[model samples]
Target: MKGPLFYAKILLFGEYGIIKDSKGLAIPYNTYQGALKKSKNLSEVSKKSNENLKKYFDYLVGLETTLVTFRLVEFKKDIEEGMYFDSSIPQGYGVGSSGALVASIYDKYADDKITVLENLTRDKLLKLKQIFSKMESFFHGKSSGLDPLNSYLSLPILINSKDNLEATGIPSQKEGKGAVFLLDSEIIGETEPMVTIFMNKMKNEGFRKMIDEDFAKYTDACIDDFLHGNMKSLFGNVKHLSKVVLDNFKPMIPTAFHKVWQKGIDSNDYYLKLCGSGGGGYILGFTENFEKTKKILKDYKLELVYRF
Candidate 1:
């Protein structure tokens, strides 16, 4: 048995800032995805995935909640029958790998699960977020639940603030020179440790102030600019946002990419920011000219995300 596909997601803006009630924008990234499938004969990879699912199933059974309930009996039966997640979404890349898994499980087993076709009122969206938060917390030590929310809906989500988000339309992609892209950091990131560092940093009043004032302001601006198709303003805000991340969120930035991150801000070729938690994984890049940015960073791998 195989279920439908669940795609990956990218948080275009508001990475850590969102933890502090800042606005964020997340869009579905269809380039990579995953789905649940069952096989008559399990291969090594599938066997490993199935084993992991067994553990996850055990975890879910212990979760205390009133939001959504899973069919643990059926889910366990399926796992024993070779049910496993067949996916291409890269784990530890901050591209919502576990999120897709959580989404697939909920889609297949949750009682009265919210379908993407529903009207998706504010209350429903929040409920889904709460449910996803609990499910995904099995992976991340703590979660905002946006990743699975984006994957489940397969639509752009505009986060106004904590507890205030809705599916919203983004500006149509255009074949313009300006673009949003991902740069492969070539290093895997663990979300739990990175989040721990951020939490520890939060003990500082200065860090808290920076997040509330600088980081959130630029993130909100970038989201507004992108939605409004205001490229001129978007680039300007992205520059500031990139600089702020580089200067304050230094620990999250991989040591190897510090110079490259600065180079983009210095040359105006592109602006680099954390894609997700950002100890490694893929770093999000913004450039006015994709070709020129590609030329400048020829040695590194680049993937185009959205054109503006």
Candidate 2:
């Protein structure tokens, strides 16, 4: 059976700060997507995927009477018939693998939680977040619901504050020497433990202050400069953001890339940041000159996202 497809998402800016109402931006990353499908033979992972989805659907079904409603019977029947996610998105890669699955399940099963065809207003978005938080909590111990929301909407979501979000327009990429790219670590990173470490780090008043004063400032500036097409300001803020990640997010960054990450900061060639939780997986990079950054970091692969 064909089901609605949900794309992967990138939390371009914000990250941890969004939890505290810091400005944020997330964009749909179309490189990976997922859809529901039935198979004749289930691989071990597929079987596990289906089994996990059943319990998630049951949880959603249990919540239906109090919140939204859906076709639980059909959904359950579909699950019994080998329904599984056919997806290119990598799990534990910080690319919204679970988020896309959650989005697809809500689309196919939820009765009136949200409608893709309808205009998504602030109220609708909030309701969708509420439903998605419960659904996605199956993956992350706690979820902000931004990942599924971005994948489901397939739109650039701007987080103005904790409760405020809307579709936003990013500047068109210009043909230029500079580019934003993703460098794959070639290892999957689990989110929950990384987040646990972050929470533990938050207990330090000093670390908390850095997040509030330093990280938030640069992240907001990066989002603002990027969306407004202010390339000069974008690069300046990216430099600071790169340094912040290097200083505080050391544990999350893969060990091998630590030198590369620092080299960029010192040389002003390319700035790197955690793509997601960052123990491994993809690392996001910003360069004032792609040719220069590439030449400096020639050993690693890069996937360009935007140009300027």
Candidate 3:
């Protein structure tokens, strides 16, 4: 049986800043998506996934009124019958493998939960985020719920501030040298440790100022410029944003990629930023000229998403 769809998401800008209520933007990446499916035959991966999901369901069921209310008996029966996610989305790729599952479970099982079909207002969105956060906490010790929220809505989400957000439309990609692409890190990044590093860094006033003054500025500019179809200004801001990631998010960058990251910044061929939590998975890159940028970084693999 085919269940609902859960699309992948890309946090174009405002990773950490959004947590503090800074402006941010997240767009659905349709290239990678997942949906729930039932199968009599299960692969090892499917078996493992189903087993883990059972545990997650048990945890949610145990929470009862304290967390979200779900049809636990129905869910347990499904789990027992080997209901699982048959998906192509890669796990531990920082692209929300667990999120898709969480979203699908909520869609199929939650009792009196927010419906994606209804006109989802800001209030409903917040409530859904809260529920997803609790549900997803089973995987990551903590969760922003953005992954499942985006997957569930399959819309471009805009973060105006910490508490304010809405689905938005962004300019479609154009055929040009300028494009956004992902470079796989070939390793999985655990969210908890990476988040810990960020929190520890936040203790310093200096880092806080830099995030508000520098990081947030360029990020906001990039989002505004991209949405407005202002290529010139978008790349200009992307360059600064790339540099900011290089400087402040050093630990998140794959060590082997340090040179390539610096190479892009120094040569202006391309600029790289974290795709998800950064430690590993795909690294996002922006370049004004794809042909030129490709030639410079020809040795490393490349995947182009847009052109300009």
Best by TM-score: 1
lDDT of 1 by residue, 108-145 (tens): 99999999887999999999999999999999989999
Query: Which of the predicted structures, 1 or 3, would earn the higher TM-score when compared with the native?
Result: 1
Model 2 C-alpha lDDT per residue in residues 1-308, reported as the tens digit of each score: 77878999988888778877899899999989999988879999789888987887767766633556778889888999999888899887777888899899888877766776798899888888877887788788889888999999999999988788888888877899989898989888988888888899999999999999999999999999999898898989999998998899888998988888888888888888888777888899989889888777788888888888
Candidate 3 vs. true structure, TM-score:
0.95
Ranking by lDDT: 1, 2, 3
Instruction: Point out where model 1 deviates above 4 Å.
Output: none
Give per-model TM-scores. Answer: 0.99, 0.95, 0.95
Q: What is the lDDT of residue 122 in candidate 3?
A: 93
- Give me the runs in candidate 2 sitting further than 4 Å from their true place: 43-45, 61-65
Error of 2 at 130 (Å): 1.6
Q: What is the TM-score of candidate 1?
A: 0.99
- Please give the lDDT score for candidate 3: 0.82
lDDT of each: 0.94, 0.86, 0.82
| Candidate closer to the true structure by lDDT (higher is better), 1 or 3 | 1
How far residue 168's Cα lies from its native spot in candidate 1, in Å, is 0.6
> Ten consecutive residues with minimal summed lDDT in candidate 2?
60-69
lDDT of 1 at 199: 92
